[model samples]
Target: MTRLWNAPDDFPDEMLAGFVAASGRWIRQVPGGVVRSTRDPRPTVSVVIGGGSGHYPAFGGLVGPGLAHGAAVGNPFSSPSARQVESVARAAHQGRGVLLSYGNYAGDVLHFSEAEAALRADGIDCRTVRVTDDIFSAPADRADQRRGIAGDFTVFRIAGAAAAAGLGLDAVESLASRANARTRSMGVAFSGCNLPGVDEPLFTVPDGRMAIGLGIHGEPGIAEVDLPTADGLAQLLVERLLADEEVPLPDGPSSARVVALLNGLGSVKYEELYVVYRRVAELLDVAGVVVADPHVGEYCTSFDMAGVSLTLLWLDDELERLWFTPADTPAFRTGSVRTSLPRPAAAASTERPDGPLPRASAESRQLAARIVTALDAGHAAIDAAAEELGRIDAVAGDGDHGVGMRRGTRAASHAAAAVAQRGAGASTTLNAAADAWSDKAGGTSGAIWGVILRAVGRELGDEADPTAEDLVRGLNRAVEGVTSYGKATVGDKTLVDALVPLADTFAAAVGAGADPALAWSKAAAAATRAAAATADLLPRMGRARTHGERSQGTPDPGAVSLAVLARVVEQSLSPVD
Candidate 1:
């Protein structure tokens, strides 16, 4: 259990504050995460790496002289927002292009991809390489679908080294991709972890049993078996890794050299890891695999999870040279690195001041007040259903959907209220809410909701009163944006399942001459039915796709939350008489 925290929601921010305070030599505080406190002698490709906050050394802890230049931290178990990623990358940029790297999780991909587009639009050279190295997450034939786990260390280190060596963006990206391709990792969990303020672990292992193929986000393992001895466990891990067809041994086993990392998940102690690594070392030696660098400690961790993972990075000549480069960070350090004078304090501010509001008609301004009320109702609905939604998500996905939705809706409501109070129109108010939701929530839900609101807002221009046709068109545009951005279809067991039905129904009802309130009521009901129907769907997208069987009896949290919000919005549209 996570026993220490002022508030569950504040844990990530608090943790980041303490980390920056203690590691002043290596990092300085940025709006989203941290950046190197010292400057390089010359401009080089900046390596910006990150993910959720719980995985320490992997992200923030690795920001320094020879690793990531900056890390965009996110809420616990959630990917950082696109704004956060862009801020960190901009802070770290030194004329040279920026290289973005992180684990290949769905939320991270969505947010980072958005950030990449935004940076490019601003004339900044930004590229990305997603590490997909966990062999157990997907079959060898579908290696690109694998999750990235402890192998993040190998990819980040190599990319950072290439940048430090003054490599161009092309070379740096190629090196990072090569590292990801050669790396393979597998983890097992003896127990699951608890998020701050959560009473129960995200998932539980039965007594005397251990879970295999576990994710770092407190996701339950794909399979369970009787716990084995240290030697037996080491043997099992080595055999699986050696047999990986996705990344074949570079040469015959006798001449292959690799970097072996025995990483401990949060609660597993160092001594126990050494005991496991001892057998792991002997097994690798007997298999004719020469260990180039043997690392045994916590590199990437799930917060307080009792588990361990083994990562092997098969090295070529160039990779081995980069692998041995000196590094100095808050957590991991190797050969001594020469330091330059500390960088002067950054003068640029990340804050963007709000501009004057656009002119709006009297009717549009009145509609903006109603929008705020609807948003308030939606927030209340999400907050009330958060715990149950989290429970449902934990069955297959990382159990942070409820927390994310609460954060997003609350931020959206606040932003809407503030904008409406400033005499903004419906379109301006919705745009403010959309930006706030995405910035604060910081995940797949956040990104999708942002797209939905922004698209709808664009259709509801400030110059005129929104009619039933305008509302229907707005909904249709939202659906189009979501589908284009998220690539989710009606049966993907995501929010799209409910959102598509709601938009289609609303459009049909309005086309039949129904009033806005009547159309909304009918649409909300259709969304509710669609959400319930997701219980029978096997998730074809996102984190839940890997554990589809576990979600067989539960509706997707995203779909359910959308339905809940739809119903609440309908109530705001037409009061009970």
Candidate 2:
């Protein structure tokens, strides 16, 4: 259990602060995470790695001279906002280029993709490599869908080593890619992890039982079984990994050379890991495979989860050579590095200015005021339902949905209030709200909502009071924006299910000459219905996809939240009784 926390939501920030203060010798504080306190004598490709914050020594702890150049830490079990990623990348980039690496997860993918585009737009020459090494997460044929576990160390180290060697962007990317492909990992959990200030663990396991093939984010394992002995557990893990044909053992098992890493998730103490690794090493030796730099300890974690994971990085001559390169970081270090380079100076300011407010007509300004009222009502609704949202999300996804939504709506309201105070139009107001919501929330829903609001804002220009036709066009744009970026369809059990019906019904009603208020009310009803009907859907996207059956009998938290916002907005549009 996480016993010492000032506030649940503030834990990530507090953790980062303490980390920087303690590890000042090797790292300096950055906006998102940390960077090396020292720089290389010459320019080199920057290898930026990140993910959710619960996993220590993985993301932030790995940022230093020869590992990650920087890390974009996110909310617990959530991806960093695109703004955070962009800031870290901008600060870390040298004259050469930047390479972003992280575990394969939906929120991480969405936000990282957005940051990559933004960086490229600024001509920063950015690239990404998502580590997918958990063999148990997906079938061999669908290895691309697998989750990244402790294998992250191998890929990050190889990429960092290549970059430190002054390799070009192409070579750095290739090395990371090859390392990822050559790596495979699997883990088992004896218990679930507790989120800060949360009473219950994300998921629970039966006493005296262990879950096999569990994910790092407290996701339930693929299978459950009675607890086994250390030697028995070692045998199970090694056999599964050895037989996983996804790992190309071209020279057969006996002649294969590999780097073995036995990682304790969190609560599993160092002594326990050594016992497990002892059997693991004995088994490998008997199998005649050469183990290179066999690492046994905590490399990644899940907020005090009682678990351990093993990763094997098959090595060729090049990989073996690269693996021996020196690194210096808060958590992991190898060979010595030049210490003459000075730490980077702190950023002057991270606050982005609100550009000049666009001019608006008197009627549009009044509408913007109303929009602010609607946002206030919506925010209130989310705040009220935050606990329920989290409950629904914990059924199949991480239980942070409610907390994330609450933060997003609060930020949105503040942004909208400020913009409306300046007499901005609907477009500017909504655009500002979108930015704030996404920036504060920093998750899959945050990214999707950002796209939705920005699309709507684009159609409702600052110059005029939006017509029914304009509203419909904006709805269409929002739907397209969400579906395109999120890659979720109507029945994917996401917000799109409610949003599509809401947009279609509203458009149809408007085309039939109903007023905007009536059309929106009817559309809100349709959305509510669609959202409720999602109780029977099996999620095909996002975190829930891995545990589709676990979500049955519950509406998607994203869909339900959207419906809630829609209903609140419609009520605000209606005439007061």
* Best by the TM-score measure: 1
Off by over 4 Å in 1: 347-350, 574-577
Candidate 2 lDDT over residue span 311-356, tens digit each: 9999988888888988888899888877748856864224578677
Q: lDDT at 160 for candidate 2?
A: 94
**How much is the lDDT of residue 38 in candidate 2?**
80
CA lDDT, every model vs. true structure: 0.90, 0.87
Q: List residue ranges in candidate 2 displaced over 4 A.
A: 346-350, 573-577
- Candidate 1 lDDT over 1-577, as tens digits, reads 7788898888989999999999999999888888999989988899999899888887999998888999999999899988898889989998899999999998899899999998899898999999998888999999999999999999999999999899999999999999999899999999999888788889999999999998999888999989999998999899999889866564655677999999999999999999999999999999999999999999999999999999999999999999888999998888989876687797233556877999998878888988899999999999999899889989988899999999899999999999899999889999999988998888899999999999888888787877777778889999999999989998899999999999999989878978778888999999999999999999999998989788988999999999999999888855111
Model 2 scores worst on lDDT over the 10 consecutive residues at 343-352
What does the lDDT come to for candidate 2? 0.87
